[model samples]
Target chain A: MTAKTTKFVQGNEACVEGALYAGLDFFAGYPITPSTEIMELLARRLPANGGKFIQMEDEIASMCAVIGASLTGRKVLTATSGPGFSLKQEALGFAVMAEIPCVIVNVQRGGPSTGNPTHVAQGDVNQARWGTHGDHAIVALTASNHQDVFAMTVEAFNIAETYRTPVILLLDEVVGHMRERLTVPEAGAIPLVERLRTSVRKGVDYHPYLPRDDGRLPMSDFGGVHRYNVTGLFHDMWGFPSDNPGVVHGLIRHLMDKIENNAHRLAHYKTYHLQDAETVLISYGSAARSALHVTENLRARGERIGLMELQTLWPFPAEQVARECGHAKQVVVVEMNTGHMCQMVRAALGPPARVFLANRMDGVLITPTDIKAHLRLIAGRGV
Target chain B: MSVQDYIRERFFPHIWCPGCGHGTVLNNLVRAVETLGLDKNEIVMVSGIGCSSRIAGYLDFHTLHTLHGRALAFATGVKLSRPELNVIVPMGDGDALAIGGNHFIHAARRNINITAIVMNNRIYGMTGGQFSPLSGEATTATTAPFGTIDPDFDTVALATAAGASYVARTTTYHVQEIRKRIAEAIVHPGFAVVEVMSQCPTYFGRKNKQGDAVEMLRRYKEGTVPLDKQPADPEKIPRGVFVQRERPEYCKRYEHLVQAAMTDGAALT
Candidate 1:
């Protein structure tokens, strides 16, 4: 007898497989609809691999625990949907300030406040960027389908470890709960990034907050021989809270520069049939899958409409989008939420590019036909 | 305790105000670590934003001073990630019970294998003298100019109800009793909360007209009734090791279950 080679898995379950393959050793989460399967799978699987799983009382605790585990040298992860994501904002800020590496999967549902628990919405697109209170750079990935969910989750882990920051895997409820066949590669088959470790030499003082001239720093874990202090307040290389103006300026500049310097490597997007096109469709997350399908369908009908799919939703992939949108006569943005990512597209397009937004906030996905209909409307107008 | 110890020597310039009760609480905590005989490398201290939270940065062990009101959350992560390490958190009243109140309740409820010592000084001494959740009703502070009409929380009772395996309370004046309870809480093997009824003489004492530090100590000694030895009056219930019991520690149970699964896999083959 042999094990089944391929089994149908929910997008949420594929997320767990990705985390495990990415070397995630701890899962601290609070259960919410649409994202509950990620928690459930980890609850069973993590303990089997000498990893830890904790169903925290709420999303705030969940985020804190994940950051905590990351500081102690474990690859940690957590999952939540709408209300839970709202609860996690403060701790998310802590992760940003302290530069802890962890992965947060927000299987998004409708709401400013738990509007529809079991329904799908991409209302969190802007939230994922500015949900936490601070001026900081965020690394977020949007998954279009189950396969992308698995692959992007692994990418999220690698990016977080490489940069030493929290990476959000943004998924809508439609993709998260929907079942599909997934083929996960063997653990060693894919690329995995581990955080840079330090060498211990007694008598040499180690500054955990030491900023590289390039603005990046390696993490020093707890129990290492290095005498290091880690704090949330603005600190010098020694990690003690400092009120000095120069130190404060240097600290904020360095923190921002670390991610900004490597923005080219961290940013990613996908383009579909943009060659010799007058009209283009720009979308992301679950809606991007529809955009891709609709772009293909429109191409078959001799319509020259291209598609620009955002893989890295944050830091916006502004340069690539500017190049694509700059050429097109008209660009239409399609998404589940109203005018969130569209605002970014408009900003990137500037003036002279007629921008049309097709949005829905009714806890339902925007279909390919709906987007195509909007494109046809834009195509018909002359004045 | 030796002044030459790695932990103590590094964490000097302790920030407690002169004759403040937090010093005694810190002293007892250090002694408890000494009594446990755990290696300095194996101990991890986590704290939040406050005067008490500053202890982590000074300590010689692996330490993290996380965001305000989120120490237990971070401590939970540290302890769970490295189950072999002994974790401790010492926080002030507002840092532990008010801003961090949700974490406090849930940490107790999960009964994670960590010891949290809350220095309950009844006021937010670090940020001027605002009334804390643990400050008693009718107590006067900077924020509560006339009187605090809000009811104070009985943190020990809250921990007990929240499922802490070991819960205890002692005033800073009772140094020996506090030291003993700290040791007991450390050894209990589950989520243990030792609420040290501390004094903030500069802020809380002056505002309430509780005299100087010495007078505040006297008031604590007179007001609290001991758990073992009872006062005749019902109102004078003493504060000394109020709750203690054995329960399943969270991380240990998780460790056992995983080991069992490994064994079962071996047997199946």
Candidate 2:
């Protein structure tokens, strides 16, 4: 049977399709607002695809289960919203420390503690980077529309598998609930990245955390002939817990360098009409939709305004932001949160650009009208 | 191969106290695996954080030392991913009953084919003799120097009520019984819990005024009553299997459901 190439799908539903296409065979999650549909869809479809889906008792267990399933050489996923994401922080850290490959989708709602359950919010932008304690790096992606949601979900999985780290797909209620037409790629068209398993014989020369030339150690399945130890503690090259300062320093450096040194390759963004633009708007997730609309309207009116929509958030795409915003006289960061990503934008641009923010956090999205008004104000002030 | 063959020699001279009952429990666990003739590679040992949880690191098998109180959840992942592997979790009282109580009950409810060996030492030995959920009422602990008013849990009863297909209780002092029950649990087709009442001499013993590990073992022997015997004192904890019955295992049922779904082609939904 041939697969449908085009279909009207909600952002959350597209996430499920993306996961399946990316080779996700195991899903463990609990029901949470906005994100529940992703889990529900997977629960219905995973079994049909001969995969496994389980509704764990809570988000913590869900995260732990995802990590465990990943250890068995299966691509695993879990979805949750704000409060549930809070509960998953520790387990997420565990995945980082152990270098397990998995994907986590956070359909973000307003929260400081279940502040608003059914509304859109970008409050988790910082949490996605610093939610888990300790010194670590993470890859987070935001989806602006249904098609991007589907495509980014696959990219999230690939990034996770390539880095052996948990990649967070941060979606807000706007895109999560909105339905749009998406062109599903045919099978074999979407590139899939699988975890690199060691070629060494099982018991001959297997070291769990020993790094190859490229700085990543190949993974081994739990039930495979390559029996090795997996732990949450800082460990030596053999995956055994160690307290030696030198070993620990090297471990931390390697973990950081893997993502930092390759940030250029991992960074992803789209620039619309950025050439010779005098003003640029920086946005991500659902808020980027408004920025795009405003940029198009303003450009038609002969305004030198462009938009730089960020698909990858964490590791911040600093160099790309700096290069894209270099020629612009002013930059405005638009978001549903008060000023989360705006800080990073300002940090990337630094002094002299007069960085401004157009934000809303009252469970309402930042509209194109708001961005237009902000631009008008800047134009009138002539500052 | 002998039990000693299962020991990860690189981690020898374990960090457990000289007379701590954890050694005895580990010995029984290794013997149980040996008796079943299960290949070491086919067995995955998991543990949460605690004195008992450390056992996973010293065993010669695919092992995961997970977050505190999260071993059962991790083990569930392993068992579901590869149903053929024998997944075993060794957790402390706090690790099993306190922080991980939700996972414990839910795992039993699902009746997943993972053996949870809860080493109930009554006190949080790793955290320096603090009160645990399994510590009896009025028991003096570091956290409760004046005496604890909290009630204790009957682990066997709790496991049985939580829908565990197999439940048994034994003390570390009963080496042969521990080995027998552990072997039985490993072979059980569904969720099985064997709660081993281990002794913590360093903290539990000194804090409670019980003599060292030897005296604690003697006291445990005196306190436990065989399941078939009825003691006049209703407070005495019962020993032996409290529940063992047949039910479809979680992973097996999941596999069957997958097969049905594949054959019916979305009609099952």
Candidate 3:
């Protein structure tokens, strides 16, 4: 009911609209393939909306700049593709270590290193979860269509603000470039998470890294009345670098536990004909689009096929995934990358033998027919 | 306000080796802010990793100790977002000219209002005295046991070529000059670079047999001449403000751009 005005736009454009809707105050990014439109649109859009945008020299600077803006109590974002994302990993880890809130969009393209610039790939799935070196936790989200692209982009910012961590929005080249209809929601329709600034008095001590009773760390604006230090070193509650054994152990644990503990609550997905399906298809990003197409076509012929489209990829919802696929006779994990999500899907389920993968890696969108062939094989028929 | 009022006293018993010139540079910076009477809450001190980078932590302001060679990039974001706030970045020799060289030039190119203080110790002391980009040829370092072959970068020259509105150089021995240059840089409204030639006596001195901290300070006084000294000799390092001129700062230009862009957005709607 809140869908206000409908327009046809690319997924990247929808992401830009969603960021403004989420009250983005600052953005700094370097342009790369597939993800360039997001930065290009924001470059033109931010200034008019009374926000700030900068095209930094490179991806590393872009990531560092957003973290800097976020400390000044601004909601910030940066977008990049595969190679750019790789360049951003160190600074992204710095954001996590310093507990700064911001969003990073990797409109994923092929490559371990510049393999394909204009082609789609979901190969960075594992990279998002463990790209930054250290035993730290991360939040990664994705969407399969233009509408979900808009919603998930907003959700990514919300998660960043609430958790005080960097949130990655993963969209493949196909989803990023594909134009589709999206209904822009009414302003204030979807709730937003505002930054929680400290209530400590101006002259009083403000701990920049201390979490209160409910695991929420209230932050003081970087240039605000309270003067405090922010650093990448293992730090005390006062935000000063500390190498004490207790301090280092406690800080890393808190960073990991904060998001990992709330993974189930953060899990988001959509089910199509899942209630009574015998064959379940698990997919995310743009691959879910093909999976849904395959499910609907098979369902029209009286087959019990279902599609589970995931929105939250990291802090992956293992328990819920196991439960959803518990009753299904066979589970097929579909993706563009060969076995990234398939491995996770197998881990989430009890009988890994029933879990299979339907995938493509030639810079092509997985088709409905491509999925049906997997189903025919699963039904003990020749491919 | 007293000069002590500018420092975070709790962080005292600071993390510098004995006779390290970085402490002197820190002292000069503190007095400079005190002279300006800038509100402690309005100053954001950012620094990249190195011995001199620790100055950000000792300052009682909004401090950010960021990744190596990236302080200027981070400071650019901070100052551009809140142009009214005074942002200062203190970086070490290699931190500034080597890893962070690109950011330094670009920040100067944008002419964003930021005071970049390069504490030039001429060696990478924190990681145990490796030869830095600014270490110059014939300098002895841990990485350059046979003496370095890499040439030094003239900070003033690099900053001037990068379009900085203000460029100056001072040494730790000239403590008063360091303070004066910092105060002048702060009041200037565009990108300003102040390179202070602080000594790393423990490494750059002992490795090259340049004697103790006091001897190094004496050499600073004897080696460099004032910029206006009559004969402009090629042998001596000249010390003074190199460039000071006016230009529209990056943030103010963006503000005017926003005013025009609002009209552009309205037309689109």
Candidate 4:
């Protein structure tokens, strides 16, 4: 392994550093709470690193700019919170439909609409998956700490480039503000993924959306000789708008299959003490930290409990959740929202596992004490 | 290459209705690009949702047909990411002024090197006949059957005040003038606005007693005054170059900053 240097950094700061290491050179964002630091840091560092940063007028424009930059063969990034993320949904859909590669960091705060600006919440879990309209696929990852934030930012870019789709790096206010020691990996140590550009001669034989044998289309830069169209409308392989049912159906299915077929490769999680546990705690993001602490304490007291911390939230990772929590007598889903992922866990675990929710949505972290209380209740039921 | 070579013929017969002035505007735009001898591969035509925005599909350039009023934001990204390409945006009156008003002003304020062509037809033609920000007061539209109380926007004035380096206005009736203005806007080296007063005979003309396409074209010829022949009445639409001044373009300034940062050894962190 290459030598690395450890430095004290906030989660948000580590996100920017990680993006730079991932070869990000274009950033377009509008400042919002719990996520503004990512944009501010990028503004200062991007120019120095031979990258570009633009503060757009609003979240919509910021998202649009990110998509535009990505089309020109640059790794682009943007960060926002609850309300800003909502404003970015339309353009986010644009990126999804156009198959642009970019990363969006949503340092989530409490919200139905501006519920709490400086507090932690994973309320955007569902929004990140289904925020945009229509039938489309997405990849989202949640980071629980400063180091995880750095590592996941790099992974977010790689996943986006590999799939040619937008990846949401979901963080909560607590992880964003909390500072910790994070190791800066040596240059070229962390694996990087670059977009596949068209190798077909420019004017000779090129169609923008023509898929390769692997089912992913190679993108061309806007100014490159291989000029072609990009549109939000349902398009044929030539990238021009088409209302033909066969073309429309093929386009949508290809987009979905590209991610769904590769779900096994993208699904990621961490398990603790699952070897002989009878109860499993299913949690993610900041809430996972609490669950892990609770699991360790309960195990010390000789309770057969384990923790399954999910890092990749979307493509739901149902198979992994089922395999890990299938045999448990009880499965408790700990989250900062009112049963967003809990519903998915239930669907994944099915009837026999007896899924239960341990949630807190009042802009406060779900503490170990609360999770322990839930575990005690489950144990008392004596399944 | 011939003008026919620049057209995406497979996507045509064009969508514009008979007598629609947007066809003329499109024709002028094509001629303008042709006059400058720009390679089709090096140009990007971006458009928002409107009848005019459909031109992006019919052009063989690198085009983006984006959301209603968000074309400028998307084009800004394309231009900044690859400054070597010439980016042009075509927007309707409602698309540019009603929904995309903020982006319009900000893009001009930045003075980025992109040419914006506003097809000011004075009404929302694509969505039927709704009153737009540029619809003349007292004009009857579907949403304003009793005559509109809302004031119309002077697109040229707004763009000029917003810091665009080049601003000009011409009617679709003045085909040669529109083509000349579009070419000038493209070569301006900074943010440029060319407001083409296009006629929506299907909506605005039918609603206002402006007769058919021919009558509306005749009215355009008779109603508008040249900038030198200014009438005392402020309502008269004057046609000419309203603003042209030199300033460093946004992308150039960004490049200079990048160069300085690289040479000074100033780390971003």
Candidate with maximal DockQ: 3
Candidate 2 per-residue C-alpha lDDT over A1-383 given as tens digits, one digit per residue, 9 for 90 to 100: 13648888889988988898899999999999989999888877889888889989889999999999999999999999999999999999999999999999999999899799999999999999999999999999988988889889999999999999999999999899989998888887878898898888855968889888898879888888877778898997767778999989988898898888889988888889999888999999989999999999989999888999999998899899999999899999998887988899888888876888988888988899888888889778532
lDDT of 3 by residue, A68-125 (tens): 8999989999999999999899899999999899999999998879989999999999
Interface RMSD of 3: 1.1
Residues B1-269, candidate 2, lDDT per residue (tens digit)?
Answer: 99778987777778899789999999999999999999998999989999998899889899999999999999998889889999999999999999999999999999999999999889888878899999889899988989999998878888888899999999988999999999999999999999999999899888988989999999889988888783665677788998999988999999998888788755633
Candidate 4 DockQ vs. native: 0.77
Model 2 accuracy (lDDT, Cα): 0.90
True contacts kept of 4: 0.81
User: For model 4, how does the per-residue alpha-carbon lDDT over B1-269 read when each residue is reduced to its tens digit?
Assistant: 67788788878898888989988988888999999999887899999998989988888888888999999999899888888899999999999988999999999999999999999999999889999999979999999989999998889889989999999998988999999999999999999999998999999999998999888888878888788776664566798898899988999999998888777635434
Candidate 1, residues A1-383, lDDT tens digits: the string is 02224558889988888888889999999889989988888777777677888988778888989988898899999999988888888888778878889899999999988699888899998889999886887888988877778889999999899878889999989989889998887657678999976563755777777866655577778765665667888887777778899998887777677777677787777788998777888888888888889889989989888998888888677778888878888898888988888898888878877889987789878888778678667768522
Tens-digit lDDT track for model 4 on A10-52? Answer: 8899898899889998999998999999988887788888888
Scanning candidate 3 chain A in windows of ten residues, the lowest lDDT window is: A344-353
The C-alpha stretches of model 1 lying farther than 4 A from their native spots are A1-5, A381-383, B7-15, B233-237, B260-269
Instruction: Provide DockQ values for all models, in the order shown.
Output: 0.56, 0.73, 0.78, 0.77
Query: Which residue pairs show collisions in model 1?
Result: B225-B237, B225-B238, B226-B238
TM-scores, one per candidate: 0.94, 0.98, 0.98, 0.97
Better of 2 and 4 by DockQ: 4
For model 3, how many clashes?
0
Which runs in model 3 stand beyond 4 Å of their true positions? A1-3, B230-232
